[model samples]
Target: MASPLIGITTMNALRHDGLAAVSLLRRYVIALTEAGATPVLIPSAMPDDGVDALLTRLDGVLFSGGGDIAPEYFGGAPHPRIGGVDPERDALELALLRRVVEDGVPFLGICRGCQLVNVGFGGTLYTHIADQHPGALKHDYYPDSPRDLLVHEVRLKEGSRLAEIVGVEVFRVNSLHHQGIERLGDGLEAVAYAPDGLVEAVEVPGHPFGMAVQWHPEWLTAHATARALFRAFVEAARGSD
Candidate 1:
């Protein structure tokens, strides 16, 4: 059988030369590829019809980590720390996410992707966790920190699909985001949580494989759990085909 084709979202970015571009980190590609799936980058500028056409061909969709989502979409309050807000990316991702969920396409989200899943489903975010979530741990371990550095423990809910795929009840994960889910989305369940009590993972009940995590598992694929997560997603996508 042919490897499943997975559509991954890209963010709006500026090249060093000051030109506009749609970019995605190669690690996401590497993660999906190593898991035996064909990864395709879906830019934010694609029109509704284009996205619709792409969805029909994709076996799975992966929303990657990037900038903070705009506050307007989810009726969130603005914060000084809010940066990298892309209107186009927000519109594209939310629309794409709703479609994928409605279509029952196997999908996985990471970091900002997790937040997107929340906001896409009428839920809100903390905007800035430190200020909004009292006593929140330092979750933004990026730039200076190694991508694979495990910063905190996330306890998985027993019997959750994530726990089943990871084969463990609790594990350390690399933290790389400032915002987090403040309210659980409709039809979504929190399947894991950080030591600080912030939601760390969520899954859509009744969906074939709808899940999202607040960590960078793609960078931590050296561990069996991370690899297993990606493999399970790819296998789910394969089954869909």
Candidate 2:
């Protein structure tokens, strides 16, 4: 049997040499590789026809963390803190996510990808959690803090797909975003949450393997739960072959 070919979305970024490029963090690749899957980085600027062709060959799609999505897509309020709004990336991901969901393709979303899943399915966001979510916890613990630092605990629903994959009901996760789902997208169910009552994870009710988490599980692969999450995703993708 062949290993699953998982497609990961990349951001439009400038290379160290000041040239334009599509980029994704190495942690995502490392995590997926360890899960027995072949990872492919999908450019944010790929044309519609190219993305359509690529999707046919992919067994699964992983939406990695990145900068904020544009407020216009989700009817979100504007905020000064909303930076790195890539129109092309936003357009690409929104279309890709819906297409994958409709096609019943296995997918796992992280951080910004989580927010995108919500927005793509007729949902809303806090825009800025600290300012919008009353008494929100400090979820933006990145750049200045260690990437793998376990910041807070997230409780999972007992019978949820996410909980079953992680094999736990409660665990600590690293917080690294200032936005959260205010209203879950249609057909999506919240499977995990933070102590502050913020949605931390969600799964599509009937899809083969459609799930997303607010935390960066890739950075926490040292933990058994994180590894299990990726392992389950890869296994699901492998079934698609």
Candidate 3:
């Protein structure tokens, strides 16, 4: 039997990249499928205003990471090096996230997804972490390396959802994003933080499972705890359906 279908938000590529090219992230898919759910990648700029149709077909939504969110949404000037900030993709994904939030569906956001979730709900972002968090732990540890992993430590909040997901109060994770969370939205709980004291994870108030992690747990291997995070997310999503 097929598993519940969860919507994965994608970044826009081009006419040749296909629709799933936007929302279907590779590690996210592997993580979701490993957790027993059917992963569906919805495009960044879906036609026919087909968002409702996409939501109807989805059991959950995962805002996969890629690109910077256009700063204009949160009343900020764009940074010169803010690469891949697509307005069209941001608009569609924000709309989808809002809808999913209203309905209390299980939602998982990683890196950019975390920023998108916060921004979608009236939060702001630091265009560049180095510029914003001066004297911070230099989160952009790997600037131009072609490798997939950038390792760093994160602090999990006590009695929060993230501590339970990763199965430890604190752990190390891979970091690749230059942008970080600035102002968290109302009703969202901050669950984890980097060594620099940046908010790393968030959970919704009284929700079964609604959380966003600042680091890319997907890129972490030898960590069943990261997989358990998705397992719990998919389980909550399944229960929602």
Candidate 4:
């Protein structure tokens, strides 16, 4: 039998469980399932005392994209643009990230997932773009536009795994994140970066396999290289060590 896959969910804050719920993305579930792993949803609301209970049953963990992480997490005050911050989800996923890292479990983090992993590991976010990175292409979601396929060219570090995965030095990726990695975490190295110098991807050195990306590859599931990412992650979750 194939090994099962895990996708982290936002804590169930409100009663509704629709698209608005603070949980795993439906697209991520589709991608994981299509990538040959059974999707198991882990709630971010899991109690601090029960963090282990959720960790033991999974082969891998995926932190899905969502709203802003409370700046209080990284010891800063909230900015006016800092809307939709979730404290419960922040508390839960931070513990989960630390636990998974200690356990040497394979993990993947998406946009907000990327930011959360950064902050969870003692890194900081740009928070507001104007306040940090001045004058850059706006990276906001455009739900109603006809040309929704927004693209930006990101340059990969020569020897980075990103280069290996995509088999290209420069690639076009859609950007929807406002906050970006300001400083990389202690054990983390950025594998890809945007033209504007925002860290687009990060990985931990000497780990089973854990990586985070600021772009939503899951949304582009049919793309060749995007599929490679899911395959690499599923394969990593089954590490021989």
Candidate 5:
């Protein structure tokens, strides 16, 4: 059987030398490759026509972590703490995500990807979790600690698809985002939550395979739970073949 082709979204960046580039962390590629899939980087600035063409050839789509989504996309006013916003990436991913949902393509979203999936489905977000969610633990731990450091435990909902895949009701995950889901999108279910009750994972009901987690699983691929998540995603992509 051919290896499943998984398209992972890239971030938009400008090099110090003054050139535009599409960027994604190497761990994402490594994780997908180790999971038995061919990883393809999808640039954030693809034209609408190109997006449709690209999705047609992809077996699965992985929305990798990146900067914050624009507030306008989710019907919110700009918050002072909102980080760099990429409208192009937001538009591209939203369009691609719609196709993925409509076509039932295997999909996994991480971090910002998770937030995008929520807004794409008409959900709202807490622009800054700590600011809006009182007494919540600090989530943006990327700058001060290692990427693989475990920051919090998320309890998986009983009978959730996520629980079945990870085979654990409670697990540790690294938190590195300031924004979080405030209102889940239509047809989506929150399958996991932190001790503070913030949604940690979500799944679309009735979809063959659609899941998003707030943590960066690519950085924790060594963990059995992380590997299982990717393996299940790859297997679902293989089913599309």
Candidate 6:
């Protein structure tokens, strides 16, 4: 059987010398490839029609983490703490997500990708989670330590698709985002949560294979649960071929 072709979204970035570039963390590619999938980088600025055309050839779609989605996309008022918003990337990914859903392509969204999936499906987010939800754990850990540090534990819902895939009711994950889902999108169900009750994972019921996690499993490849998540995703993608 041919290896599944997984489309991974790239971040729009400018180099120090001011040249434009499409960027994606190597960890994402490594995780997918190691799990038996061919990873393809999808530029964030591709035209809507272009993305639709590309989707025809992909076996799965992976939405990787990056900048925050624009507040306007979710009908929320802009907060002072909201990070840089990439309208082009947001537009492209939102359109791409719709096509993926319509076509029933396997999807795995991580971090910002998780939040975008929620917003793409008409959900709202806490612009600044800590400020809006007092007593919530500090989630933004990008500058403080190594990416592999296990920062907090998320309790998986009993019998959830995530729990089955990871084979655990509770597990530790790295925290590195400031925004979080406030209202889940229609047709989506939260399958994991932190002790403070913030959503940690979600899945779209009735979809072939659609799941999103607030943590970056790509960086946690050594963990059995993390590896299982990727393996399950690749297997689902492979089945689509």
For each of the candidates, give the backbone clash count.
Answer: 0, 0, 4, 1, 0, 0
> How many angstroms is residue 135 displaced in model 5 relative to the true structure, after the best TM-score fit?
2.2
Give the Å shift of residue 163 in candidate 4.
2.0
Write model 5 residue lDDT over 1-241, tens digit each, in one string: 6899999999999899989988888999999999999999999777649878987799999998999999988886578888878888988999999999999999999999899999999999999898888689889997899999999999999999999999999999999998999989988899999999999999999998999999999999989999999999999999996
- Candidate 6 global CA lDDT score: 0.91
lDDT of 2 at 70: 93
Writing each residue's lDDT as its tens digit, candidate 3 over 1-241 gives: 3477888877767556454343344777887888899987777667765878877777888888889988889875578869987888888888888888887778899889998888887888889888887566766655565224546678888878778766888677777788888888877888888888888888887876788988777766348778888888888888877
Give Cα-based local distance difference scores for all models. Answer: 0.94, 0.93, 0.79, 0.77, 0.92, 0.91
Candidate 4's displacement at residue 176, Å, is 1.4
lDDT of 6 by residue, 1-241 (tens): 6899999998889899999999998999999999999999999776647986887799999999998899988887678888768888898889989988888999999999999999988999999898887689989988788888899999998988999999999989999899999999988999999888999999998888999999999999999999999999999999998
The C-alpha local distance difference test score for the whole of candidate 4 amounts to: 0.77
Pairs in clash, predicted candidate 2: none
TM-score of each: 0.98, 0.98, 0.90, 0.90, 0.98, 0.98
What is the RMSD, in Å, between candidate 5 and the native fold over all Cα? 0.9
lDDT, residue 180, model 1? 96
Model 3, total clashes: 4
Worst 10 residues of 6 by lDDT: 44-53
Model 2, range 76-153, lDDT digits (tens) per residue?
Answer: 999999988899998888889988898989999999999999998899999999999988999999888999999999
lDDT score for residue 83 of model 1 = 96
> How close is each model in CA RMSD to the real structure?
0.8, 0.8, 2.6, 2.6, 0.9, 1.0
Candidate 6 clash pair list: none
Shift of residue 14 alpha carbon in model 3, Å: 4.2
Residue pairs whose backbone atoms clash in candidate 5: none
